[model samples]
Target chain A: MHAIVCIKQVPESPSVGIDPKTNTLIRQGIPSIINPFDLYAIEEALLLKDKSGGKVTVVTMGPPQAVDALKEALAMGCDEAIFLCDKGFAGSDTWATSYALAKAIQSKAADYDVIFCGKQAIDGDTAQVGPGVARRLGIPQLTYVCKVREVDLEAKKIVVERLLEAGKEVVESRLPALVTVVKDINKPRFRTLIGIRKASQAQIPMLKPSDIGCEEEHTGLAGSPTEVVKIFTPEPRKGGQVIEGEPEEACETLVQKLMDAKIL
Target chain B: MAAAGTAAVRAVAVRAAGPRSRLKQRTKRYRLPNLRLDEENCTGCGACVDTCPFGALVLEGAVVRILDSCTDCGACVGSCPSEALILERPKAAGPAVDLSAYKDVWIVVEYDRKGVSHVALELLGKGRELADRLGCRLAALVLGESVSHLTDELFAHGADLAYVVEHAALKKYRTDPYVETAAQLIRKHKPEVVLLGATTTGRDFAGALAAEIDTGLTADCTGLEIDAASRNLVQTRPAFGGNIMAQIVCKRHRPQMSTVRPKVMELPKRRDGHKGQVVKEEVALDDEKFLTKVLEFVKEEGSTVNLADANVIVSGGRGLQDPANFKVIEELAKVLGGAVGASRAAVDAGWIAYPHQVGQTGKTVRPKLYIACGISGAIQHLAGMQTSDIIVAVNKDPDAPIFKVATFGVVADLFQAVPLLTEKLRKRLGK
Candidate 1:
């Protein structure tokens, strides 16, 4: 029942503003948190670990500052945490990112039975990396998974209900498979005092490309098949009229104007 | 016998390449029939050849011969007069190609009950732009039962060519068969780019199809540009909760793919006499190839809050307090002849179903008039509706963030303001 979960660190946004004049994101003081969707993935993994009486290991690939995210996951009850952070990994798209992750899993936790990932990272929302990893590893993929029905460790099989466009479909896949879980799966547990203390003092071993057998040609933007060419802001519309008057008078004016326009 | 094609259409998805016997490969398998081309009932009318977008089947002498290019899309199965075309699910492999051979830009024309979809029409307008810039031909692949008549509309919409595929297996939108048909067309014709609508159905299977063909697909793109020097499509979309925009390109992949959200692009003007080539293609069908079946399609039940398609949307938040209070919101919507929408907070509070929620995790809506009442402007909510043409925010708090994006702002308690507005509109409209 051992599970390996992949999580990513994302900016706490929807509040973070962008500078219209500079055409840049305002991230100077905004804090970062684990991707909300990945939290569900972690929870499902921990739940499986509990049921089978085995350990759960979490992995992440990002810049050096990503260690904070790994520490947070450890604090949530993962037994082991590994971070893959190197300058070469910068600017990697979903393809290269999945390559680095799959390589790390192969090097670090090759004996694992099930590998879990969030359905998508809210930041990118491609939902490509999970399937990409499965293809590269030559394994089966079950995506948009909502519930875990059964886990037959001895039979090397697991059954789950995957959410599709219409509804849920029950699917069974041989173990040593990859699953991208959706938020409907489970609610994550908060860090406890004992778990917090253990995580705060834990030493997370950071690995580089060569350490995990990832080639330089397949680890960064150079290895990525996709490229970002240009970026511009979406045009904003003209502001509407905000009527000024007493609440009742303003309401009357709105109705009168709409009627004159034959709208209401 | 057809040459072993680079891709197989709707065959068993599992690869039995690892020395597993055909018998051993069976799982909780479907007992239904596989894709079979029954020769006894052959009419040799060559209709199947015209219906196969992949150019996989041909009428030679008097018999229909499947080519090596067959991707196994079952467009030909149901069109045969004597039921000559049949299918049987088999262990399969993916299409392998020399990337240089691919050309042109193709759009998968999707339709709803109301004929061709708005998203598909929008893509045609955008596709014409890209095709012109790249100096390549623009094409549309329309698939369905008895849908060839739409070719004239496709041509008028600016598709230089239309590939019409028809089959009984395609009467309904099924992921397995649709992707099989689409992937096989890519493998055989080798289109440089493919566009699809970023609707619920598009998002459901777009990634899986990309995986099947071993290609990259960018989802929900708001902007697309051709990189002149590289002849590549630069796909751009909002990232990190709309804080930043990321422009992505499939640098090495042969056919770059993207799913554009509906209403993001303008539709092409209809030209009454526009003409183009229409190639009819065919696909085989089998019950085993389909992973799931659609029991019944329930029309979007009660409230007409199809936020995505609505021109005017009045959304409420948790400030409404109780489910009963939604009546005021509905009243306002009814008077305006628009739809009633709610924020995630309202949906989470059990005031409404999730279909009415407007936020990042919810549906992205870009209506002409978006009125937010009793809703605190959260970034998540704004991300979904910020693109609306006219935004109006009403809240008791004067500094609520919703006002930032609103074209009109009102600082008043919704209880006093909303009902008054609704009453005035109802009286003024004689409703």
Candidate 2:
């Protein structure tokens, strides 16, 4: 089985600056890293590759510099990497993003049997893209997966544990399915020297809208329906009053405060 | 038809130009196509009609047509059957909101059989501050059966006005009717900021309402403030497994919307005999229009100690070891009349349920006093309780990160410390 892992790069800090004119993230000088959650997805894919003897492909959509993130994923044991980069793809919302990704997946449909993604990107915690991509591709998607229980290669079926609000449910789906993984899935392995050497020389395939048969209109800001008209940070919380007293006295005082607040 | 076809052919020709002509020739190719409608796949369910707030969709000759002045907000996409309708970006941008039209801040007072949820009142408290800062009025949108009786209560709790939407159809929580009623009320009186509780019902309702209004909404927010510079609602929530806190803003949309989790803010002090204008509005609702039926409402039986609402929480950690050993922590919690919480380690070990876990993956809490028993705080764990008013750490390791945030740090084994603490509290309380 061949697996593809979708990853994204996001700002490392919460202090992301937005361009007032465009209402878009100002990424000119901001430091970015592979979305932390996607790391677990890459790790899980590599683990599956190790057990089943399959090739893993890491794909990411961002500015040209995002190729570095794809290279990093390759160093962690992915066999190949792809970058969906173009100026037209800028300012795409989750809906348009998933459309572009789904088109890219269709371009490589013959090779891949399973697609893996982090439950949600850190910068945009909508958790909608993976499911959206699955919907666009007309494939079954199991989100918030915590563990992979079994894989029947001959039967072309995979069983995994899905994380629900109360507990986990064991779900079985066919091959060519999409699974969005959470952090508890697995601990990612560190890159070895051999893997680093291979990644340094690896040539990442850059795919554009023409290569994927996607209309240029559906790939970028032009295709995005939702818009971020404004961006701002939340106000700082008011500092709480510190109660200084002995343990017994403080406990009594706290209880009285709760009662006064009618919260007790 | 000829002119439209010629435009499409020209678009194709321009797009066919190579990457080298990246700057100039692409200008004409930037225009987006009309929203695609697959007539064969359309089920004519009228979902897009009801869901479209801007009146963008209309059925003509058994087919839906996109109107010329559509905003392309994508609200109709979720409601489409056979996935026939798709949102296509317009060649020209939609009209942007003129912020001067919006004025006061509003908080939706969400009451049920259990009375008003804490987050509503918390938002009211927060809204009061923002309204004061912006020199605007703070109003509460109260909707329920005979809810006008609670208008005085809403005014007492800091609401300058109570916009009541009372109806028999709203007696129980249902999605379609409630969203329609609330959205209509919002359209009638456009408040600059609208807040709701992050409870199950609130999340469901807020998502639909925001989608209907074609606005932005930040969910499960821990903080809210008015940007002194832009007068925008700055909503903050935990993201990425609570690794970092993200502050979001809906600048262009009116009624900057957000949902605050319970116990994240302080409830406002009530002023007795406070009076405010109660505007009663009737939402058009018929018996046949209600699609989803509520067969019955079954209340779960339990001790009824909602940890999310608990002000004082006594949480245990892995050092407690076994499921049976958790009884000591519970005893101590019971003695103090507080809810019992647990670290993710304990929850994963099956010593307690996941709801009791306090961490990034678990619930974000800001209780008045959080007692950490044997929790060697990891960053994930700290993300949940770091905002507590008073933290007391009890663990054998003196260097635990919990000590950094704890008001009083006791370096003692939880096995010894917890039982002793429980006995002391029990004796002190004469229990």
- Which tens-of-lDDT digit does each residue in B1-431 have in candidate 2? 00000001111122211121222312222223245678998877766664432334667778886543233334456668678976544463443466688888888887755666667778888889989988999998887777777777788888899888878888766555676788898888888888888764565466556655656667677778877998887777664334334556665568777777777777899898877788888788884655433433333223323466676889999888788988888887787777788898988787886556776555567778788888997766776777777777777776777776676566677787667766665665678
lDDT of 1 by residue, B53-121 (tens): 233466678888764334333445655667787653222222234556888999989886668878899
Please provide, for model 1 over A59-118, each residue's C-alpha lDDT reduced to its tens digit, 9 standing for 90 to 100. Answer: 988644456667777778888987876645655666677788889888888888888888
Which stretches in model 2 have alpha-carbon errors above 4 Å?
A1-264, B1-95, B144-146, B166-177, B220-223, B227-229, B236-248, B284-305
- Give the Cα error of residue B124 in candidate 2, in Å: 1.3
Query: What class would a CAPRI assessor give candidate 2's docking?
Result: incorrect
The superposed Cα distance between candidate 2 and the true structure at residue A175, in angstroms, equals 21
Query: Which candidate's DockQ is highest?
Result: 1
TM-scores for the candidates:
0.74, 0.58
Q: What lDDT tens digits, residue by residue, belong to model 2 across residues A120-202?
A: 66444555567566656655666677788777677877888765432455666777777888767777787666776676666
> What interface root-mean-square deviation (Å) does model 1 yield?
17.7
Q: What is the TM-score of chain A, computed separately for every candidate?
A: 0.87, 0.91
